[model samples]
Target: MIADQPQQTRDPQAPKGRPTPKRSEAQSQRRSLANSSSKMSRKDATRRQREARRADMARQREALAGGDERYLPARDKGPVRRFARDYVDSRFFVAEFFLPLAVVILVLSMIQAGAMQTYVLLLWMLVILLIVINSVVLGIKLKRQLRKRFPDENLRGVVAYALMRTLQMRRLRLPKPQVKRGERP
Candidate 1:
């Protein structure tokens, strides 16, 4: 038993009871070693890419922090632009709907003021018809204005967006730049 005590070996090879090396084992070992060598080099690739991105962002921020404010020529940012934004946010609603409402209110007040003008009595039907017409016109104008401002946003993942998205046929009702009466697409 004392003689069967473990023997010490410095030159460590594959451990005992491991699978016997096959004929292709040498080739596989060499290939794997080469792969691991190459892979190690690319381990820092992502870090390097992130570093580059950070550097670029830092440069841009530095430029922006300084007085290097670059303006895009086409992107108008003057008083007119501010006015347009304000109009869209508030005044557009007043113009498109409230003005018509105010007109109707004014007409009602005027008629209630006195019957001094005999034209109202004579053309009461005409006046009523005109008010209705003005209301319809105002409604249409308001709808168009709202559509232009907020826009009709289509819900995502519907049949229209998924299947026939390319065919935006809603524009057919609008006045088109028709190629002559007998022209082809």
Candidate 2:
């Protein structure tokens, strides 16, 4: 029977065509291949990371300034926030003038006359009160509108968000106003 089969014999000392790779060696080669696409020095890696971060920030700022919903951050995303922003933007709120009004009051308070200073203080207080009252009213209206528009939305933090947006000068609000003043939301 042994003689009937094709004669196949090998010299034990003869070299095989190629060595079989060890399991560890094969795994290491696979890992190297998988990770070999890019190789950078520490400095280059750091510089690349910084450039990426700066580009991201620039995109974010552009989105905020241009009212580009696609690139807006998580907090500014979604139709509910967009409606809230538009609602606040479409109206003229006294709080929107708070910064400039405060500056005026500060200048007035610096005047030499005691009566002028007293009047400036009163004016400052009056402006603050008006701003607070306006914010409260704006918040109430915004909440009602948001509830009507987005019944299932979480109302938490929305009032504050709308009020804060209202307090910002129209020209300075981030996610810059898409609607002009007096436009319906």
On TM-score, the leading prediction is 2
The residue-by-residue lDDT of candidate 1 on 1-185, one tens digit each, is 58888876544454563555886998899898888767756768877998998887675555433312233122222333222222222211222343345566557657644663454454555555654565445445444544564455422222212112112222221112223323321
Candidate 1: segments with Cα more than 4 A from true spot: 1-37, 69-185
Candidate 2 displacement at residue 179 in angstroms: 0.3
**CA lDDT of every candidate:** 0.41, 0.86
User: Across residues 66-136, which tens digit of lDDT does each residue of candidate 2 receive?
Assistant: 97888899999988888888889898888888889888888888889979988998898888888888888
- Give the runs in model 2 whose Cα sits over 4 Å from its true position: 1-44
Q: Provide the lowest-lDDT 10-residue window in model 1.
A: 159-168
- For candidate 2, the 10 contiguous residues with the lowest summed lDDT are 9-18
**Number of residue pairs clashing in candidate 1, backbone atoms closer than 3 angstroms, sequence gap of 3 or more or interchain:** 0
